[model samples]
Target: MKYLLKGAGLALLLGTTAAYANDGLMAEIAKPEQWAIPTGDYANTRYSTLDQINRDNVKDLRVAWTFSTGVLRGHEGSPLVIGDIMYVHTPFPNNVMALDLNNDGKILWRYEPQQDPNVIAVMCCDTVNRGLSYADGMIILPQADTTVVALDAQTGEVKWSTKIGDPAIGETLTMATMPVKDKVMVGISGGEYGVRGRVTALNLADGSEAWKAYSTGPDDEMLVDPENTMVLGKPIGADSSLNSWEGDQWKIGGGSIWGWFSYDPDLNLMYYGTGNPSTWNPSQRPGDNKWSMTIMARDVDTGMAKWFYQMTPHDEWDYDGVNENILTNQEIDGVERKLLTHFDRNGLAYTMDRETGELLVAEKFDPAVNWTTGVDMDPNSETYGRPAVVAEYSTAQNGEDENTTGICPAALGTKDMQPAAYSPKTNTFYVPTNHVCMDYEPFRVAYTAGQPYVGATLSMYPAPDSHGGMGNFIAWDNVEGKIKWSLPEQFSVWSGALATAGDIVFYGTLEGYLKAIDADSGEELYKFKTPSGIIGNVMTYQHGGKQYIGILSGVGGWAGIGLAAGLTNPNEGLGAVGGYASLSDYTELGGQLTVFELPGEPAAN
Candidate 1:
């Protein structure tokens, strides 16, 4: 009763305090100075309020500074620039480096950890570094071994390292973007293998335990109350087979929070999405897994869940909900409400109530999705594909293939490069999409740690619809929760999002181009190719009467690396890669951080 009263009182205070800033995103869209707040403000829109380089003068934008990460493998880490400093991470051994964003990219300090070379053998995705975190004068780096390490933001010194879960127990993962707040919001990997899945949080100040929430369980350790009030977690068990398979697969369930997480301060909620299950065979872990493939709402301080709405229940497809959950409010069905949205790898455009976790609207965000007709609320709907146990490919006649139905959006969805960011001012969401498909052929396998990490093997084929290249920049509508406008490109969008007050949405392409698009309409405003491939998130900010935009230039990961070889000759849309994985030829490039600003001497250019 005491917790409830306190929660209600805090809610009432926030409800009344945000009245003036209630301009949809304004209430949450962070300021440029608060670049410390990664994902552009708390809502994680990746949008900036500074307008130093608006559309009319963005043409004058030129290079301001560039920093290189030396280990050139996969450059997916989104740089975090807070106050006067910027933090970056690299793939091998996962090192953390801090530089002065205000300087000409001068190295302020470097903190390298004695990481294990063996951890490399465990990562399911590319050996890449997504990013780190900064809050309370400290930097939080979520390492490959499922450990969250804190560093002094001013001086690159280790503050504390909290090894939350074991990567050996299926925890090897990366940021692909960086960590936000000191919220040690970490999750497990090994979904391809038979590892358990879950996400947890720890205090950054002294590495104390804050909260933990698992991916699968009705008898979950965490329980939440709607209306933004109470949250407590305790292990609970319930039938998950109705959503996953026909039997008791939850016994070894696999839905992880391995993608990205966002926040909404006004609502005081932290949002994170979970990944898909292992085996790709639905029969293994049957039923709609609880937090997996769902965007969950939890209180930042206590780690209590407020509400959760599953996007894909019992997702037979390899559609892990490992995308960024961006926060933005919109008017829908003639009603104005707060919005929680994401571009799902499941090929779905998901929008829900940020506070209650109710499905406000869900649609097919992709052009080629054949998994299911659409989102069905019923538990017994046979529309949800069966497990791979019934597959004809299996030697056993009764065995089958449930996931990987050869949809247009393969494991890569309508949007895979990163999460689509929105600009409330323009009322549009900026997103990246790949035009590709895969014919999934599932085979039984096992998880023996150093052995083949996945329990099942899948052979991928090409899509019939995509005419070559990957990526289409779309200007989406938050109001209607639909595509406002779109333009196709040859390369996949591997970088993060950048929305500026200057009426431009900045992002990068796999073919090494940092481009800008008109925020209101889907039109290319400017494009510049970097040294090699571009797979980093782009950010914009200002210091001494100048505006600058920046992103990393290197390509790795399935989003960029796999496409490199298949892109040599160029067939249709910008050399869409077929199936080439290693990028030894470009490793020497050592990913450069290119910063652009208005022409000097005469500032305006």
Candidate 2:
């Protein structure tokens, strides 16, 4: 019945939300009938009400076929298999392609936007696109230039393109993840240089700016300012954010929107996590910094602000609140209610009122750092460690490697590979995380659009016990606000998780092994290897009776740095971050799209 209701909601969404009803572009894309991407439909449930591939036979899974994508930079985008066709976007501009899933590795059509190669130089992350969004009959893509481009779903042709940012202004549009409609929400990156952050929604069909929201406001608008930025709670003159800097950091304040975005279509609302504040040094931006390190909920159509809850106030650990929010319903205190849950970078799992953005619970998901006693919502906002987390960062010239101060979750937790996916079968959300801490010291530097993120140095340390480590997969019950079960990984699992009807949860590890686990009890059921490492999104679909599982195997992503550095650590042997985790010790720069199905015959991709 819940599954049927979800389908009905998608069916209704197909016809309603006619605000951009021109060209029927969004109307014919098929009812929001399937879990097309990461958010699992327009709303980010992470839970699919379907259970075709239950626990019993999930162990029997095998490879179907492999499609080689010769060009590999960072494979983060999940393949969107719509009907018999699969649409995918690769790194850089104009790399979108449409492949036929009817036969293994068949190229139906490939469309490249052919934008200037210069744009690739501007991307903060390794030229990656999370995935393409489909609605009506068109596919929506955020190009390297921060422009939203619509592609014809069947032909893989561009329908329209709207520039979202000015690259010249140090503002670049590298949509880290796919955009969810209602909010058409997109986040900014370039945080290393103090670029201001924003997420905007445009009319889906016409690509017109519906509304725009900012992460950092004026001095009076600044929520957390160490300097006297405001006069009686209002904006005063002299923007100290500009004191040490050059370029737009003083203006935008580097609250990069580069996080996962999810939506709740039925409620006509969307949620997105915000990135860390600019210039890792806490003393610079002083106040709680408004929307940065926060989660925002807004109406999908009007793009009006609904509610926002800050995860970390005046965060100094470079911990961005940019993680996925799972929309689930659970009975709390005997009352069943709609709720949104997130395991934030602040080492906490939060359950909030989906419609009104109320923080019902903000429980520590990690015990490594207790920078704050707890969250308080009286007037409604976050209050950090009694006197605020001390970010005592000193200079190297003064002779120091940025003396480390222990901070929980290191620069990697709450949940990294898209964070905790929910499975309706067990009513649980599964997440992969890095359980570690770091002593981060600050260093001052000039702001450059395409340079490294300076201003704070990080010295990391492992957890004293096993509860937290470089990697963890935890099953959390939304109603309880607690961990149901957890399994540790050898390395940080950076791939987005997928829930299949196969009665299992599938996720890729950094070193290339895609593992399946019993959704009920944290039992390892199956695993396989890809070309390199799997740091992207893993998805599953069924066509022609055979169910299929697919994801990328690339090692150039964030995890590769440590994996590479670990390789040179003679003390650690040849085993790298994800080494020996079922993946062979090999460096295959080329990434291929591999799918697994029942041995012998190939399934429709």
Candidate 3:
């Protein structure tokens, strides 16, 4: 059961790493001059070592350039910059555009796929593409039409394309692909539509699918070597995932992998989380629903699962585990361990040993997380190895079908696809989060292909004592498992965060403001109003000898949908998941890429 990253795979990875070294890609990424990977680096820290745009001069930052995508939807991802070229992807029809960074952000080339128009209806949240990844001179994009395409990094021509999911049955692709070694890893989206989720690896050269492992089903389908799949130092045993479900529900059990991914080159394992089970009505499908609401560590080449840990067993609320798994090496209780930190949608934060799938620390990142009283990890304790569900919030299980009231953290849980940034310099994680709660009522839902499969009608509002705000930007200390500092916001912080070595952390607000705060003290330093609310990550790169920061501005995600569509149902607060109905008073809809630089710098080329 021992796995080694040897042979061609190792060589492919070494080639990438060496090429990265030769071209100084790693060094460039560290310099705040080039934003290489989507997650910044393989560690997925989203931390830049750039110091030029320090706190002292951040107020001098001004608009350098802007580009219009012309598609007014949620702009949920950041642009990828390689050398002098920057790549951007749009929603729905999924257009890929490359900008010449040296020529004042000129349009170099644009590739737009003729995707099925009907595909938009099946998307659970707002239509979002989480950005692209560049590897070995190719830009990898996961399209919403259930296909992954590799475009020529230089010319924007289609190199190779492979379909990974079936949109007809409610599967789509929104997460960005991760390029590891010679394989590009991608996952599907459709937990709400009852489509079984999966993660597949494609040969980076020709786009042929290498291997796929499902989030549900039998051990063979999941590539789960249960005898070797250690869950906290003990074997999970054969058919561990399959037996956890009732009947044949595992076929459509909904363990989607639609979030961010991280990797450890030395361990040769890719870490990703899976979404919740299908039919949010937990009573329909019983048992632990293993693999759903879980994180899995898998072999990069073969897609064999080494181990997994379920964050929520039989998720009653729609607490999807599809959050980013950030890889880092941190010390815990006096020993340095290869750690994977995840701020789950279930309102709990976990720090685990990525090498062995052992839980090291579990705590709440948000204080209002009341769905579960606590995550019990002590093996010998009576409430061992599961979340201690709070009876008041267990509406679905409490058999209150007529809209049970008062669920803290709402069905949105605590965070969404907007990922957190980890700064190695300050050893602090900057988390963008939601501070809303909900009232839920679950009804029976019959599955139908390409239709709304959700069984819940929930109304969300800002948590009580939340000071009338729906979001909080916080700095979390993972080693100590504590919140270092928090800044409350008028709306949910739907955008991703960027932490830099210069003691500044940047993020966008749902009200369309881009702000840079003191990374160590949580003091707002600089703020700029954009054309629309921001739902994208902040990426920084140096072009023409000037450091530049950029993010996409469009207000159409689940949090911003009410505002973008101009839905003003103040009393009900029903649509757009009922949480942000008041958003229209703050921002409107638009799609633009805004770039900023210091006032003195000659405009980027």
Which numbered prediction scores highest in lDDT against the true structure? Answer: 3
Q: Per-residue lDDT tens digits of candidate 1, residues 251-366?
A: 34667667777766566667777777665655455455555666677776666667665666656556777788776655554555666777888777876667666554556655
- Give the CA lDDT, 0 to 100, for residue 51 in model 3: 70
Q: Runs in model 2 with CA error above 4 Å?
A: 1-35, 176-183, 218-250, 376-402, 448-453, 467-469, 561-588, 600-605
**Highest TM-score model number:** 3
Query: What lDDT does each candidate get?
Result: 0.61, 0.61, 0.82
TM match of model 1 to true structure: 0.83
Q: What TM-scores do the predictions have?
A: 0.83, 0.82, 0.94
What tens digits encode model 2's per-residue C-alpha lDDT throughout 345-383? 777787776766655666666555555555653432233
Which of 2 and 3 is ahead in TM-score?
Answer: 3
* Lowest-sum lDDT 10-residue window in model 3: 2-11
Error of 1 at 418 (Å): 0.7
Overall local distance difference test of candidate 3:
0.82
Q: Which regions in candidate 1 have their CA more than 4 angstroms from the true location?
A: 1-30, 101-103, 176-183, 218-248, 332-335, 377-405, 449-463, 561-577, 580-589, 601-605
